[model samples]
Target: MSQILLIMASVRPSRVADQLADWIHARNTLGLSIETVDLRDWPLPMDDEPHQPKQEGFDGYRSEHTRNWSRKVDSAAGFIFLLPQYNWGYPAALKNALDHLYSEWQGKPVVITSYGAGGGGKAADQIAQVCQGLHLEPVPTRPALPLKAAERTDAGRLVDPAAAFAAQAADMQAALGELAAALHSA
Candidate 1:
């Protein structure tokens, strides 16, 4: 099975990143095995590894949390990051979590689903560049699902969910599955 790790980059109690991820993952992924990693579950502080880990083998981090995170990344065939734009960028939690690992991310194809009032394009763009530096393959077809800033959610129901946005969610999820499947073969 092609295992894909779905990461939700939000720790805030009311943030919508995980909700968005669930919304996306609920669709058909053509039988792909899906797992989840939410920052809220693995709250990481600033990168505090005692030493940088080995690049190829992925060994050396002193922090158990970081080691666990690396193991999670190493286990997945690919990834989907639900990065919610905060103040025109991704949350520091996501950055810190990413900084904890190095070689584990290399060559992995990541599907970045960025959402925000301003389309979360900037955050996605920034992370793509970061991923490049880490030698990870951010998927060529980046899915930027921009949500309205003032969009409301009451007990999980989006107050004004648009048909276009819903369609985008479905389309992006489908494309992401296809890309992940192809990457898994490579």
Candidate 2:
């Protein structure tokens, strides 16, 4: 199976990031392997290695968490980052995680699924730059999920299972499908 890491980029309490990730995952029908990776489970600290990741490599990763996470990135053929915009940017945790690797991410295809005020387009653009710097292929066809039209709220609780989110989910799944095809050709 061509592996694709579905990264849940938000780790906030009472958020819709995971549910959004799940929506993309459930709609995947391309037969590619999809593994959901929640950054919350991997508490990676700041990038403080003696040398850069390109020079240090996975063997230089003294921390077990870093090494294990490296392996996951190394194994993936593509990625889908479920981005929850914060102050018009991606979460710090996601940035730290992406910064912790080098060769493991080289040449891999990545699709951004951004959700927030105005669909997190600013964050998507910023992340695309970051991915390019890492030598990763950032796909251009990103799907945006704006909170007002896409999110369902009931009694002050955030819910995303309503029919309103279906359109956005479908668009993201299409982007994911394109990523899978790009990965095969990459």
Candidate 3:
């Protein structure tokens, strides 16, 4: 069975990406094993690698962090990026994570799902461009969770991710189905 990684791409202390990820994991009916990987736990330094990821290639990574990250990404059959939109784009942490490894992401199936005030369409589209450069195959049904003012608290925290994004549940499932089909074809 292929395992699908639900990558929490936001590292903010008050971010609700985790809540969304947990909800997605709990609601999984696709039969594929899903694992949550929070970028906060990884804490990879910005541009720490001595050489470009492409230059290093697989097995040529000099840093243990890169090697471990490489292994984790290599092990996944597909990825569902639980991204948070920041300034009309995805978080830097997510971009840094993607930049740390090269071949590990090549030709892999990925579903870019974003959440923000405006549905995160811009952010998702931006990341899709990056995915192209990395040779990661992205499905067309990118699910965007649009957060409304009423859905958030005074502190800008989510009231409840599951309830907030309930309407988009079908869209998410469709994205997951697309990812499953992509993985199967791969």
lDDT of candidate 3 at residue 52, scale 0 to 100 = 84
Question: What digit string (tens of lDDT, one per residue) describes model 3 on residues 1-186?
Answer: 898788999888887787788778765778878889999989789898887885443357788888889899999988999898889989999999999988888888998899888789999999999999998999989888887632777887778887777888888888888988998898
Best by TM-score: 3
TM-score of each: 0.86, 0.90, 0.92
Model 3 TM-score?
0.92
lDDT of 1 by residue, 1-186 (tens): 777888898788777665576666665456667788888899666857766655766567787787788888888878888898887788888888778888787878888778887678889988888888887777666676767643565764455444426657665766676666667678
Output the number of the lDDT-best candidate.
Answer: 3
Candidates' C-alpha lDDT: 0.74, 0.82, 0.86
| Residue-wise C-alpha lDDT for candidate 2, range 1-186, written one tens digit per residue | 788899999888778877677777777877778989999998887976665675443358777778888988899988988898899999999999999888888888999888886889999999999998888897868998887765456643346544657767667768977897897787
lDDT of 1 at 12: 82
Which of the predicted structures, 2 or 3, would earn the higher lDDT when compared with the native? 3
TM-score, cand. 1:
0.86
Which regions of candidate 1 fall more than 4 Å away from where they truly are? 56-58, 149-151, 154-157, 160-164
List ranges where model 2 is wrong by over 4 Å.
56-59, 151-162
Off-target runs (Cα >4 Å) in candidate 3 are 55-58, 153-157
